[model samples]
Target: MSMNTFPIIRVVTKLLIPYILLFALYVQFHGDYGPGGGFQAGVILAAALTLYGLVFGLEAAKRVAPPKLMQRLMALGVLIYAGTGVATMLMGGNFLDYNHLTHDVWPQVLPSGQHLGIFLVELGVGVTVTAVMTMIFYTFAGRQHIT
Candidate 1:
């Protein structure tokens, strides 16, 4: 039986996708304080995209997150992660030093330096991982397997 013929699956997928994305965000933001972190959140985010592709179609998934955009995101994520380390160095501290993340001129609304640094690094990791996993799904889906 073709899954495409089932309206129920599509309906459920549509209902669940948003919640999945929300949970991913929750895990991402709370990661440094708890068990969940970049890797788990990234996988969760990617799963949402994959579920949409499975219910709808590979082309649809690509439309939602184009390969070009994913590629650019991957690079941007890495840059963010590495740039954090470099920023600490430039601030006259050892690489990846959260203590140096704070500056005298920095706004007070944000969290402490350690928390802020962890947030940025985790954000980068989550982005890269989500892009990579989603791209992998797209790659496999697009290919015609020899049977």
Candidate 2:
């Protein structure tokens, strides 16, 4: 069965994307004080990107974010979060311990750097999740048969 690509879908997709991104950012940053961290943000971002893929088609989505690049980016995001923990451990502290970030800077610098690190990790998670979701949608959305 074929389905119509309606104008409403385009309208909704365009209007909702920015809000989705904003909400994801809020969830990512506010997680330290409460809940809803990288995972939730990633999901939201992925959902938004998937909608874009659905409305726009696989080629457009791939143009926006290629599949191979998405795979590497997702792995990089995981590695970054893991790397920070490993670096802390190598410094003889517990995993994710901020104090290991720097020596000369002391208490303030370490916390600041840690906060920045967390933000970068969150951003990476968001980007990778979005790209991967788009790629998955593209793969599953069906292909035309060649004559």
Candidate 3:
């Protein structure tokens, strides 16, 4: 069936998208100390974006979530994750070996830098997951410009 130019759907998308996104961000950020962390938040955020595209069509969604920008952001997110690992390796250890990061590579105690690195990597994973899934949904919708 065709879902083109539905006034009701347009109105619904306008009203709901803002709230959904706000909640999604809340979940993404606030989950660190509570139940359901970044991954779950990313899924929810992706779902909200997908729903916007599904109801309003790909073109409208693209105005907000541009495919090219989304692609770049997704790549950047993954780069952040991988960069953390690479940095650790450069510091003289295997992938994601947090121990390699510190004021002194051979320090006796584990530095807080290791914890910070892991947190950054996890944040990158969440960002990539959310943006890439939204991009995929937009591509799947394929700019339905039916009238």
Candidate 4:
């Protein structure tokens, strides 16, 4: 059966996608304080997109987030994660030393900087994972043929 054949599924999926994305963001940002984290958030986000693809068709999913964009996202996420470390080093601290993330601006805010650094790093990981997972799903889905 096609997605269009199921009005209820289409309507429900459309209504739920926003909430899924919102939850993913919450997991990504509130990870330090709660049980969720980058990996979990990334997977959640990818799952939402995968659901979209399943319901809307792979071509539609590709139109929403093209493969090229996914590749770029993967690369960009890694760059952000690595760049954070490089930035710490440039600030005259050891690698991955989040304490130095804001030493110059506000020495008193060292802890805050650490939180910010961790958030950025986690965000990078989440983005990379989301992209990779979605890409994988797309690859497999594209290969399938109805008998």
lDDT of 4 by residue, 5-71 (tens): 8889899999999999999999998999999998999999999999999998889889988999999
Instruction: Estimate, for each residue in 29-127, the C-alpha lDDT of model 3 and write its tens digit.
Output: 666556655677778888887877777666777888888888997998889889989998998889988766675644565346655565667678778
lDDT of 2 at 50: 74
Q: lDDT per model, in order?
A: 0.90, 0.70, 0.76, 0.90
Which has the better TM-score: candidate 1, or candidate 2? 1
Q: How accurate is candidate 3 locally (lDDT)?
A: 0.76
Quote the lDDT for 80 in model 1: 92
Q: 7-48 in candidate 2: lDDT tens per residue? A: 787788789988997887788778666776777887887777
Better lDDT candidate (3, 4): 4
List model 1 lDDT by residue over 1-147, tens digit each: 125889999889889999999999999999987789888999999999999999898888899999999988888889999999999999899999989888454677777788889999999999999999998988888888788
* Clash tally, candidates in order: 0, 0, 0, 0
Ranking by TM-score: 1, 4, 2, 3
In terms of lDDT, model 4 sits at 0.90
Clashing pairs in 2: none
The parts of candidate 3 lying over 4 Å away from their true place are 1-8, 90-94, 99-115, 143-147
Error of 2 at 64 (Å): 2.0
